[model samples]
Target: MESTEPQRYRFTGHERVFHNVSAIEALPEVMALFGYQRAFVVCSRSIRRKTTWIDRLHARLGDLIVGITDEVGEHSPLSNVLIAAKQARDARADVIVSVGGGSVMDMCKAMQLCISENAYDRESLLKLQFVVSGDGTEMLTTSQAPAAIRQIAIPTTLATSEWTPVSTPIDDETRLKARFVVPDGSPEAILYDPALLQQTPVRLLWATGIRGLDHAINTACSSSPHPFASLLAEKAVALYIRHLPNLGDTTATDSFTQCQLATWYTGMGQMSVPHGFSHWMVHIIGPYGDIAHSDAACVLMLAQAKWLEGWVTPQHDRLLAAIGQSDTPFHAILHDLLAGLGMPTTLDDLGLTRAQVEAMIKPALEHPLVTRNNVRPIKTAADLRAVLDLAWRA
Candidate 1:
């Protein structure tokens, strides 16, 4: 029974999106449009060393390339972000061009904050980090200063970090992650080149594709549903169902493009909806156990589906139809899809132990996103532990 209530939605402004085989060729024109004379490149060390894509970008940008910082780490460590920020400042860069995965994009966003607020020291930076209040409300402490520079993201994976207005940087010393949400944190423009995506490792690419799927699933099943967001989520699920299996064929450029589009749709959908326990669990597992973000999602998504079994809304039926499963349970359908992609479906497969799972429960429950934003209320440690246990051997 669909409710006849009138719905409203808000746009996050029109960002220039370029998608083509030659999308990277438009960087100079994009820079001209923004009056950005000096563009700094931020990416992971692996992307810099292993691929010729950076070399081509440098050649194309010519004198506009101010500096290239490849020091970004997995999870966007604060120390690394500060280093990158210092480099960008020294170069006098007017804009940032991030060409890699989620970590690199997130690092650039945090670097923007560090540069804007002059937050150099760890203590000063930590003070600006977001915190959860006693009553489970998220409190952000961004400086009043406006951002001096913005990023033009060219993502190589389906993590969809480029489209989000939030940045999560991990503290190297404490191994705790902090979220920084600011309106200017999102990228100013995005270039989706399927050819560039071919440089990504197959396993990582497919794993991140599942992460995109998780976004669609969580958005579609949100307790506070938005009509437009539901439409995008359904399309995202359908696109993934069609293209994800073809990712192993290295030459499938169209399939890669479709996956990127699927990521974009899911990213937009999740922006207006609430995510559930799977996202929170992935956040904990990534920092605590030193696991990759996408792999963590692959391990926990089915467990979250199991937990939401009876509580899920009718929108979940759309997800089932997308995957060609009419009467099958949502978790079972997801398990089969992940299995077909050769993704890990259990915590054991990800090499997480019961002790580590137990250690995650307390912190996971305390995180603002987990406690305040989840569809299902996570009130006690036991409730979280039960979900973790199901993920352990599911």
Candidate 2:
């Protein structure tokens, strides 16, 4: 049943999504839209050394491409963010063009904050975090400054970090994420090229699509449902279920395009919806086990879906209808879908031990995200442990 609650859906820095088009083709017009020319490109090191994509981009942007850095690291380490922030600042870059996955885009967004606030060091950067009170109210000071330096993302993976203004740059000192909700910090425009996605290794590619699928499913199962959010997630679920199974087909560019489109619709809606245990648990278990975020989602989504078998029946019905299949239970359907995609489905499959799974229990219980937004109440270590047991072998 839908809750009788009013909700506000906020749009951030997102302006345009140029799909089925390469970055070299779409960037100039996007730059003209903002009347900006100077671009500081950020990408993965592999793309820089291995691919011609960067050289091509440099050729296209010409003098407008002032500087480029590929040192953001996998998790967007805060130290790396500080380093890259200075590079973009010194270059006097008007925009940051992220040409990689979530970490690179996250690095660019944090760089925008560091440059704008002129806060460089860890202590100063840490101050940017919002404080939460005992009553669970958050206190934050906003500059309300219009975004001076926004980002333009060309994602190589299906994790749709480009759609969000919030960036989580991990602090090396604490080994945890520092969240920043910057005004206009999101990509001002996103370029989605299925051809670019094809360059990603197949397992990695399918895993990220599963991550996008995670957003759709968990948002659909959000305790406080927004009708529009649920509606978009419905479509997203269908698309993901349809196209993600075709991961092995390298020639299937249109299917890959469909996967990319599915991510956008899911990301747009899930921005407003509070997610469930599967989503929040990914943060802890993924990093703990050194698994990629999307890979972690592949395993945990199945685990949590199985765990929630009885509790979320109504929402499961909604998802079933969306996929036009009312026969199989949602978890089983998801398990078969993931199996068909050759994705991971258990903690064992991810190479995580029982000890590691046991270790994450305290953190999951302690995490404010789980406490505040997880679909079901997780009040104790036992509560988390119960669900985790199902994950041992899926």
Candidate 3:
């Protein structure tokens, strides 16, 4: 039963968005709009070493690029972020231009916070994060105001970090990820070029497509669902179902653009609604088990759907309909889609032991975001362990 009461929707708008082949050409105009002169570029070493895109971008930006750092690691670790922040500061950067995957974008966002707030070390950065209370309540902490500098994201994957105001950076000592939520943490602009996306590894692109799918599914089924968000999420689901299968073909540039559009829709949906178990579980799994964020979705989404079996709302039916599988069960349909994409469907497939899965329960139960935003109430560690047990196998 859907609620009939009126609802409100709000989003932090980007200064500009460019989504076509001419996206790279629009960077100068966007920089002018933001009054940004000196740009510091952040990306992964792999992108810089293996691709000529960075060189082309440099030729385009010319003298505007003050510095470039390609040392961003897999999970945006705290140590690497500090180094990037110092590099940006030393360069006297006026803005950040990130041109890689989610990790690079996350590193830039974290660096922005650290540079603005004068949190130069791990202790200071950790002090700025929200913490979970003994009773599983999240206590959010606010920063001073907006940072002086902003970021421009040109994502090469479907992880959709470009559209969110949240940043997750892993701590080196604790080996746990911490969430940083600043009102102005979102990028000022986003460029989604299909040619740039074509440069990404097919396996990586497919994995992140599952990540976007997770965003859409979780948003549609959120406990506090908004009608507008549901509509966007439904469209995102349809787009992915239609385009993701064809994305592996090098000639399918149109498919790449469509998938990018789907990610944008799901990214908005994620911002509009709180996520559930799969997202929360993946955050924990990524750092603890050394799993990629998107790969964790491959292993956990089915089990999370199973946990929500009887608890799911009519939105599940809408999802089934969007995927053209109205008569099929949601979990079965999801499994088949993942299998088709060559994604892992179980923890064993990801090379995780049952004991490691059990170990995650205590931390998952205490995680602020996991405890606060789950559609299904997680009352105890036992409840989390139950879900973990199901997720441990296919």
Candidate 4:
């Protein structure tokens, strides 16, 4: 008998802009929506070091700004979440405004939850924190449940965290792949500003550009399909295909808009199918491999895409064409593009030795989430081993 399980989902997003806007004017309005008088701005060390945007935001927001928490780091590690939460608590910040990429946004997301609940560890936190009423009820009440944090995201990078309900957090002990926090854990608003992106490192600019592409392509090929999201994903693919090559040559705003649009659309798709093997593998190898999330994500995209070729549908075919390739051998074409973008084309480049690959299989095979969604299911340790072999040899 064929197995039966639910194959569809409803997606919701944060109430905010995912487009280019003037930060000087937008920040205050977002703060007002969350009813926050004092905001604890969270950002990456890199953004803090390089940009005057944060200072300008503080100056612009004036009294609404409580203080700044500039200690956010890469990967939204659990420890850093604790630290930021503590700092936000100490400052008595009424709301959080994150002003960087995925890492910063994710950090604020977690901080909101921790502060609202007065808890630090994820293990101690309540699961299924919010539920949509059958009659369409929203908002979790203090009487009915524990409260979560209110967060606002000002994304400077195109990694699409603003669009996703899932947040990747690093494990302290293993230092490997972390847990995924749910959408209810996300910020209340996401403010997109292209001016903030201008200050990003050239390398990060390219990496996040590819990162946004991965979001689009991965969603296009996800197990669950939606006509609207597929169209948006194709559009995102077209944007990256055109803009990525012109990095050294263009001052294009449209491409970034395309990326932002794609990120927003695909981020919703992710709520349904989310990421597949690539995301799982990245999670498996992240902390353990010392690979950056974007780098790890891009590294596995083509390899996973190659695996996804056999599962191609008309929708997938159209998406492939948007990236300037025919459906036939789509994986090969995608890999070629990834190689040109300076992304790691193989697992070896990610510091995974033969022994480590062998060690990673058990955990990967055990992960029900990623393994189950694969176009070709991964059922055994050997199946994961083969995927690892392909990734290692890439």
TM-score list, all predictions: 0.94, 0.94, 0.95, 0.87
Per-residue alpha-carbon lDDT of candidate 3 for residues 87-202, written as tens digits (9 for 90 to 100):
99989999999988889999998898888888889988887775443433223336675686789998999978888867888998999997886556779999888988988889
Considering lDDT, where higher is better, how would the candidates rank from best to worst?
Answer: 3, 1, 2, 4
Root-mean-square deviation of candidate 1: 2.2
- Model 1: how far residue 100 lies from native, Å: 0.4
Deviation of model 4 at 314, angstroms? 3.1
Candidate 3, residue 226: lDDT: 85
- The worst-scoring run of ten residues by lDDT in candidate 2 lies at 132-141
Clashing pairs in 2: none
Clashing pairs in 3: none
| Residue-level lDDT tens digits of model 1 in 1-394 | 7767554454543368887646468889888988999999997777789987788889988899999988888899999988888999999999989998989998998888888888877887777766554533234445677888899888899978877767888999989887886447778888888988888888889898888888888878876678788888889988887888898898888899999999888877676766777876788899999999899998788888887787774667778877677799888877888899899999999998888888888888777777555566666887787777788776
Model 2, 43-149: lDDT tens digits are 99878888888898898878989999989786789999999989888999989999988889889888888888887899888878644435332323353455668
> Model 3, stretches more than 4 Å misplaced?
1-6, 131-141
lDDT at 146 for candidate 4?
38
Q: Lowest-scoring 10 consecutive residues by lDDT in candidate 3?
A: 132-141
**lDDT value, residue 323 of candidate 3:** 81
How many pairs of residues collide in model 1?
A: 0
Error of 2 at 276 (Å): 1.7
2 or 4, greater by lDDT: 2
TM-score of 4: 0.87
- Best lDDT among the predictions, by candidate number: 3
